[model samples]
Target: MNWDKRYKQNDKPWDKGAATPVLCELLNIAPQYFHPNTTALVLGCGLGHDVAILHAAGMVTTGLDISETALQMAREAYPDLGETWLMDDLFNMNSNETHYDLIWEHTCYCAIPPKKRQDYVNSVFSLLKPGAYFIGVFFTDTGQPPQVGPPFSTTRDQVFHNFAKKFQLVWEGKPSQCYPGRENREWVMIWRKP
Candidate 1:
């Protein structure tokens, strides 16, 4: 379960090496919503492609990950980002009542142990300003669970149900192209804090 070691070994199958297609589509379809200067946070930003893109577009972006190796790689790869790359467990993030306008949750939810799903939801909710938005992409599958997983699979209903208490589901759909291994299994979701 040493994620840093896995990244060091170049074993991250979840690292698509690019910004997610769904995120790109979101930016394209609603450019006004994803304003360049909006304060944004990205959870579990592995290689940081999304972080770099947001930074380049002028957002005050912060990328958080548990693995030092991944953070180092992200910093080195996008030195110009000048992003706040922090090595901290997402569940343990203490923003002290400060909230972000947008939170980009790409692969953090399903990657966590199932028992901690609610905590993840609560933590993210705690970090968002009232009426702020959260855009997430979750993986779904019908097969047996993997022996070891950072890319775990979850059902769409479960995700919606979990967030319903604290958020309103504004948009939910699937993008045309996901990374090779995730095609047909990703749900693009947009939720707004109440």
Candidate 2:
């Protein structure tokens, strides 16, 4: 598969090897939103690290990725974490039409081609239950879009234009957590379904 080749070559520089610290902070800040019964979906959950975090938080979690190789690696790395990890196309996967309480997004938005961004937003909105949460860490572009893709850069305004119509902007700011050089390179965004 296209994505599987990257893992076969061990080329996933984007894998940080752990859940984003901002996700932990979100849980701490809004403990009420995450509970044992709460269902959370992690989109493009490459190595299932964030899925493990959600599992530890006592929420029913699922890790979905389009890459089977990534899913295999994640299952091996986090075998003890009880999570439902699946290989599915994000644009096609549905939560059995049940929707989720929270959608955890990290690096997924920036990875998609700009042309498909609208599709991404529509997919997320459709998969969330009314009044649910969509917490994400979006990669921001310092300037114009790059010539190559897969890690396309974006801005806050682009994000707002994409999902703000369907989801309410709850929080938007630079994240306190970063992995070394990524201090101000990404935007921590939270949106709620109205």
Candidate 3:
């Protein structure tokens, strides 16, 4: 998919204007996992809402996206966060720049083609500091045919199969709050790289 062109055309149906409530709830319920020195990488951080949330929580947060337009929009919207926006492909991040204490996944996982799902898991595993966390709100069911997606639907087994190799499950459950249509479709998970 031409993400830059999509951003250029303002065709982002997935660009919710704010951070996922799931992240907020996670912070509220598990504050011990986040701290001022924590370095967080938010994948596909379109418009920067979740990045802002993580920053506000006192982590050194970086919002990374493949679309320059999306990063530009993020920077414009959060001008004080000048250094927080990064333009890079998730799969091709600079080797020396890959370490992070936390990686926050929201729309990025489901937005990628299904065939790349395992690579996504491996890439995330390779980017974290030992025992660092991988926290995300995944779209388990998009209510569309399973085969048709950019926002692909997935199952708990698939999640386990992809992440079990390198991550230890910390916590996971459906969030109490969600964006309008996401109700039971969203799954919030926290994993630690051990």
TM-score of each: 0.92, 0.93, 0.96
TM-score of 3: 0.96
**Off by more than 4 A, model 3:** none
Q: What is the TM-score ranking, best to worst? A: 3, 2, 1
Instruction: Please write out the lDDT profile of model 3 over residues 73-187, one tens digit for every residue.
Output: 8989999876898888888764745599999999899889989988898889888999899988888989887678888888877898788888999988888988888899988
Candidates 2 and 3, the one with greater lDDT? 3
lDDT of 1 at 135: 89
Question: Which parts of model 2 are misplaced by more than 4 Å?
Answer: 142-144
lDDT of each: 0.83, 0.85, 0.88
lDDT string for model 2 (33-99, tens) is 6878789999999999899988899998999899988998998999896448878889886555759
Query: How many angstroms is residue 88 displaced in model 1 relative to the true structure, after the best TM-score fit?
Result: 1.1
Residue 115: error of model 3 in Å? 0.9
Residue-pair clash count for candidate 3: 0
Q: Total clashing residue pairs per candidate?
A: 0, 0, 0
Backbone clashes in model 3, listed as residue pairs: none
Model 3: lDDT to the true structure? 0.88
Query: Which residue runs of candidate 1 sit more than 4 Å off their true CA positions?
Result: 95-97, 146-148
